[model samples]
Target: MEHSGKNKTNGFLLMLTLLSVIAVVAAPFVWDRFMEGQTGMIALIVVEVLLVIFIIASSHSLWKNSGSGEWKLKSDKKGMRVYTLKNPGETWLKIKIIGRLKARLASILTLMRNPDAADDVGMFDSYYIDGWDPDKDGVDPKLVYYTFKQKLFPPFKHREFVVKSEFSQDPVTKEMKFNFVAAPDKLPFNKRYHRVTEMHNRWKYTPLENGEVEYEFIYDAVDPGGNFPYALANWLIPAMLPFAFAKMPKILDKEKYRNAKMDYVQEVGEPAEAMA
Candidate 1:
């Protein structure tokens, strides 16, 4: 099944590449024949440039393996390290973060299950508009959430996403994984916000002997819709991750999260010992 999916993807990428190349080659001639003016010439050039960028970005994103790339260390601070990979022909960078936090797995899971609770922490208050479980009924392990958020900076348009989130623990290793992926066609389109169509992220937590939880975060890729420049967005996105992660310890220190306990999640040791 997986191989079939890959073959389909490769075929699609090839078709897109051929079409893009043809368009790029034919654009100037079409402009010269049909529209012969300075303004028309400028528009033709813009179209050609955009088409080229699309071809490169799309081809790289679809064909290249997400994990198979040279990653450069971007930041190391407060026990967290951030790495980024700029794949050839891609406009945006893939990011990965590894860190150790003085928190329990249950507490982390609690936060993931209730992301809107972060609004009280003030960090995401302005950005997070709302979120809810689509099923309405309370369920364990798997949940579909629809989240609406606004950009932190200007051109503060809203972005909506529906993602299927799941929590799983390895029986042997005891490591916990929280995975999220874009859920397509789950809800009707809303005119209020731009719907984000592509996103895949995962968080892995490994309990250490001394009670600290070592965590790794992977952001595969995301396409923030609208006219935002991909280059600028890529730069700004990575710059914000460190700040967000540095605040995690403090956020988890809150009474609600610090004292959290879940029956589904197994802690490394006693909460008191871990906190101490």
Candidate 2:
């Protein structure tokens, strides 16, 4: 189903490109034949200008969907490096962040289980679990449902996401992973904000030999729904991610997270102390 969606998007983009080329080539002849006098000339100029803008925006969107671009370094701050990539035939931009945290897998998992605790980080205007499927042992549930309300700058309205996330561990690498996607139907819609229903994201944690967990985040695609321009949103997202991540080191320093331990997680060595 995902492949089919990608094919449809690519086809639509290709048709749009062909149509744009035809319009550009035909505009001069149209103006020469039907246009007359200053009024006609002004109308022609206006039409051409609008067409050019449309073409530019479409071209930019096409390039991002090409999926051949390299990971562009966007930001490096507070021990994390954020990179952005445009995957082929994807509407939303993809983001990857690589960093190390002075915590164990269990600590991070505990954080994931209690996402609302991180609200103090100020990354989102509001975030909390709306629902979940509890584990039999009453520990970490395999699936969690949550929502995030992000307050955007002026002219852009707030954005919200209702998501369902699942946790897993790689048998060979022992890497802990969380996969999440927008699940709009999981909850009733709210009219106050734009709801994001197109998103696929993942987080992976690999324990390193030096007692630090290598933290990697992959935002495969996140389409902030509504009329917001994709180009502007793409640029703004990367710029804002570093600020959100800068708060992580401190969040992990809290005793609840720093001292957390789980029998299921395989530690690299002795759990390292929180970063100063």
| Residue 43 of model 2, lDDT score | 87
Minimum summed lDDT over a 10-residue window in model 2 is located at 267-276
lDDT for predicted candidate 1 compared with the true structure: 0.71
- Give the per-residue lDDT of model 1 (tens digit) for 1-276: 996797687788788888999999988777787777898888898888999999987765764533346888988877789999866445567889999988877678877766556474342322111334333446443444545444445665666666667778775556889887877467777776666778898999988777788899988756666666676777887888788878888888888888886666666543433321
- Which of the numbered candidates is closest to the native, going by highest TM-score? 2
Candidate 2 has a TM-score of 0.69
Model 2: residue 159 alpha-carbon error in angstroms: 2.0
Model 2 over residues 21-91: C-alpha lDDT tens digits? 78878887888688788988888888878877888887877676676557888778767899988767665
Which stretches of model 2 miss by more than 4 angstroms?
A: 1-48, 54-65, 69-79, 123-140, 170-174, 260-276
Window of ten residues with lowest summed lDDT in model 1 = 121-130
Which regions in candidate 1 have their CA more than 4 angstroms from the true location?
A: 1-68, 120-140, 269-276
lDDT of predicted model 2: 0.73
Candidate 1: count the clashes. Answer: 0
